[model samples]
Target: MIVCVAIVGHQNNPLYIQSFTEGDDALKLHHVVHCSLDVVDERVNNPKKSGPMLNETYLGLLYPTENYKVYGYLTNTKVKFILVTTDLDIKDADVRNFFRKFHAAYVDAVSNPFHVPGKKITSKTFAERISTIVKAFGLSSAG
Candidate 1:
């Protein structure tokens, strides 16, 4: 059975989750923070020897120490999905100011109750909202 995992997040930050079954070193190490699931981690970290670059990137940030949440879940069939919400805190006044225009659109519009779990998020409203937010924050060039 093919397990599908969908990760949706705010415009400024995007999540990268790699499947261990695919044997690409560059793709595995690229933008991956950490693997919560044991099997995934073992395949990427142990056998592949991808090093601690992901953890280093995550821990090396200069942001204040706080419990910034990373969103993720495992399906009943054991497929995992993860979302990295923000690279840094949105609580900072300057950061919040930068994202103010997109705040409502993110917290309310895209993540609304109508969007069901485990489903591919293809809402035009959501996409448009993200595009507006990205442009407003000058994050169009951001990866």
Candidate 2:
């Protein structure tokens, strides 16, 4: 199950952070995502030099905690999708699908006339979209 989701800006600042874990574990989940940023940064700068780079967005599993694993996807515009899941062995396709849906939601949010690119997303409809994504994927819920 997904424990947290984060939308990180190009400059490494978190634009949005959603914790799916209940109570104190939420804090721990945030830290896990925060630490995973370093791995995302490294992968962005020095991507695997061997394989055919069809779409360099999916960075794969960044790192693992005892209870969760962090997965990262970087958009062309440099926004990041950081997903923390309780399952350590989550499939790459699942992560990709989630990020794909997330990307669409992000685009929709940014397309709003009053929305700013780097600011935190506060749209109720956008939040609902994300919540639906979590439910569709049988993810955990926040406290």
For residues 1-143, write the lDDT of model 2, one tens digit per residue: 77789999999888888987666687777788889888988886776666676458888888877777888889999998998888746667777888899899989999999998788989999988998898776642321
Worst 10 residues of 2 by lDDT: 134-143
lDDT string, candidate 1, 1-143, tens digits: 01111233322122322222233543432233343243333433454335654332121112221333233333223333443233453333333343344344444543667865445455677556655544444342232
Using TM-score, give the best candidate's number.
2
Best by lDDT: 2
Cα RMSD for predicted model 1: 13.2
Residue pairs with backbone atoms closer than 3 Å in model 2 (clashes): none
- Quantify all predictions' global Cα lDDT against the true fold: 0.36, 0.83
**Where is model 1 more than 4 Å wrong at Cα?**
1-92, 98-103, 110-114, 118-120, 139-143
Using all chains and alpha carbons, the TM-scores for the candidates as numbered come to 0.32, 0.90
